[model samples]
Target: MKVLLIGPAGSGKSLLTRSLGEWLRRGGYSVALVNLDPACGYLPYKPDFDIRSFYDIRKIMRKEKLGPNAAVIRVHELLSNNLEKILPELKIERDFILIDTSGQMELFVFRETGPKIVEALKDAVGIFLVDATLMNPIDLVTLKLMAQVVRLRLNVPVVPVITKVDLVPEINFANSAQLTREIRKQKGSVVDLALALNKSLDGFDIPVRVIKISSKTCEGFGELLSTLYETYCECGDLT
Candidate 1:
């Protein structure tokens, strides 16, 4: 199974990718962690497979007189051409593959370069992580837009995840009234965003599930794991 991790910068996409890969491996699934962020200089742990072997953003920026965003776009252009070489070189023997993409969420989700990557990896599961801090209605509206972009342009099944929930324990999914009230206080109108998202996803069976996870504390990690296993794995195949 191919999984594409997409999220805004500093939204815990890389951390989740690392934690998920290690957990999957511990569960006896041979997994390959592909680092697709060429501009990313540091990783907490080494990735099993990385694209930095093909292109380095520092070099691209210096050679092309581009800013960070432009450098990322350049990396995308380079990777699109060289993906065949890159993926094969990964030598992924696992049943599942995890792609840790750039934190520039819009760079990928809203651009042709991003759609091309998803199209190239059509077999992959597309996961979009929204910061738990953005669980408010207004931010959810923005996330809904991001989700729509992923669904409409990428042609991949999208999963919405809320990260950093450990930071806020009072807002529990089990308490709908409290959650709704908190959401209203945080954002003006929860119903408005929900209605907007519902209209945008007309006829499209988008699997929208909000998962809470903290890579630091491992809070809600088990639920996240169970969700992925149930959603993506075969009958006891990758369990």
Candidate 2:
């Protein structure tokens, strides 16, 4: 099973990738971890295949007389063309493969190169995460909007996850509880928004799972693993 972990910057995608890798291994599965960040300075776990081998945005921009933004665009193009070349080098014997993608959400998810990479892998799963701290009405609405974009472009199963639940408890307990109470009070507003978002999706029945994982306490790790296993099995990626 190949899974892609995607989220905005500072959304804990890398840490989740590492934790998931360990979890899969403990379940008797060999896993390969790949870092797709071309400009990443350091990674907590070594990647089997890194995009830096093909293109480094900063270095390429300097050599080609391009600005930083242009450099990143060029890097994307290079990866698109060279994706096949790198795939052969990957040993896919592992039962699970976790890909750590760039924090540049739009660059990868909506762009041509991003879609091509997903096509190169068989039975790929897309795990899109939203920071729990960003769980406000307006932001949740925007997230659903982006989910539509991803669904339209990618042909893989998209799993939406709420991350950084550690911050949930830290959120003003009074304010958080009050919001929940308000949600209960104003079910018309809150529940209506959720229902509308679900109606907008193709598979409205696939409920969004909330995972409050802490690399610190390993909280919610079990739930996350169970969800991932069931998801993969249901998608026929796991036997």
Candidate 3:
């Protein structure tokens, strides 16, 4: 089973990738962690297969006379074109495979590269990280919007997670419907967009769970593990 970790920068996906891999390994499951960030300067855990081995955006920027933004775009386009090459490195069989994505959300998810990566993986579920300490009406609405984008664009199951729960006393994931109603009652273009996304998602009954986890305290990792295993089993990815 493959689990894709995606979110904005500083969303703790790297930490969660390391933590979840340890949890799975402790449970007697083989785990392989993949770092899909070509430009990552540092990673907390060593990856089994890192995109840097194939393409490092920083090196390309220096050698090809490209700017930071252009270098990232070109690198993603390269990854998209050479996705087949990545397959050979990812052929190791494991009970769980955790994918740590790039921090460039738009370059990865909002574009063609995200879907291409998802299509390359079998029975993979996305874990979208939302910073718990930054939860507000606007942030929540924006998160819902991005989450919908992942579901619609990638056409796979997405689990919305709240990272850094150690900083917050409580995080609410169940109130999204009510939050949408409140947003609709208000008058604004952003709220209007949020309301529309809520309605569209409601019709599809897409399961967007709000999991609160903290790598500091190991909070909610157990629930996350159970949930992931259940999801994989439901996908008929049984060993």
Index of the highest-lDDT prediction: 3
Candidate 1: C-alpha lDDT: 0.70
User: What digit string (tens of lDDT, one per residue) describes model 1 on residues 170-224?
Assistant: 5464223343454455534556665555445443553445566777677776776
Clash pairs (backbone) in predicted model 2: none
- Among all windows of 10 consecutive residues in model 2, the one with the lowest summed lDDT is 171-180
lDDT of each: 0.70, 0.68, 0.77
The C-alpha local distance difference test score for the whole of candidate 2 amounts to 0.68
Per-model TM-score, in order, reads 0.82, 0.80, 0.85
Candidate 1: C-alpha RMSD after superposition: 4.0
Candidate order by lDDT, highest to lowest?
3, 1, 2
Residue-wise C-alpha lDDT for candidate 3, range 180-201, written one tens digit per residue: 7567567667777777776665
Name every residue pair that clashes in candidate 3: none
Error of 1 at 132 (Å): 1.8
Better of 1 and 3 by lDDT: 3
- In order of listing, the candidates' clash counts read 0, 0, 0
The best candidate by TM-score is 3
lDDT digits (tens) for residues 1-239 of candidate 2: 78888778777778888777787678788889998877667787878877777777777977999876566667877877876777787656788788988867777786788888778776677777777787764355445555545645766666666677677755331122333343344435556675455345424544444445665456667776676666666656322
Show model 2 residue runs off by greater than 4 Å: 137-148, 170-195, 198-205, 236-239
Task: Let me know the TM-score candidate 1 reaches against the reference structure.
Answer: 0.82
